[model samples]
Target: MSTSIRSIKSLVPLLDRVLVQRIKAEAKTASGIFLPESTVKDLNEAKVLAVGPGGLDREGKRVPMGVQAGDRVLIPTFGGSPVKVGEDEYQLFRDSDILAKINE
Candidate 1:
């Protein structure tokens, strides 16, 4: 799929939802040996592409989200809904579902 931000920007998450693209697993090992595709482990790292407006609180205030677009985040090993845009794969998770923000 086209990895252009333009294509991904077309999707706008809603109500605290986030759209994330997983960071691909490395094809090469630490010693520089090329690992087969089947042996590559899926990484739990992801890049935040888009985020929804914060959800409303009981007091009718908008609760701001902690993570923003362009942030690198750590995700759980499983449980997000998968999304397919062209040949690319993405995941949808709520703000609370995201594990942590990664600092570069």
Candidate 2:
């Protein structure tokens, strides 16, 4: 593994937050044609790297998290906190902010 990935995994989120790595948009089309950077649109898909412990509920009970580490999920287009680990960039989102867990 690269040093950056190892470095990033060292960070553990706390209190219902999740750490994820955004899946990059394809730079090439299905036809094998290379596209310019300007033409590439960012994808909302991400891979869960680490997740915090479940958050507390209003009744003081522990709420289970919707997603777990290593799950593929769809994230919102905006509003996640940006994080940089070594040379890689990751995003931190609330477990609730994750749109959905991808079946694939």
Across residues 15-94, which tens digit of lDDT does each residue of candidate 1 receive? 88988999988899889999999998899999999999989999988789989999999999878878777777899899
Q: Model 1, which residues run further than 4 Å from truth?
A: 1-6
Alpha-carbon RMSD, each predicted model? 3.2, 3.5
Which candidate ranks first by lDDT, i.e. highest?
2
User: Backbone collision count in every prediction?
Assistant: 0, 0
Evaluated at residue 52, the lDDT of candidate 2 is 91
Please give the lDDT score at residue 32 for candidate 2: 96
- Give candidate 2's TM-score: 0.88
Lowest-lDDT window of 10 residues in candidate 2?
1-10
Cα lDDT, all candidates: 0.88, 0.90
Model 1 pairs whose backbones collide? none
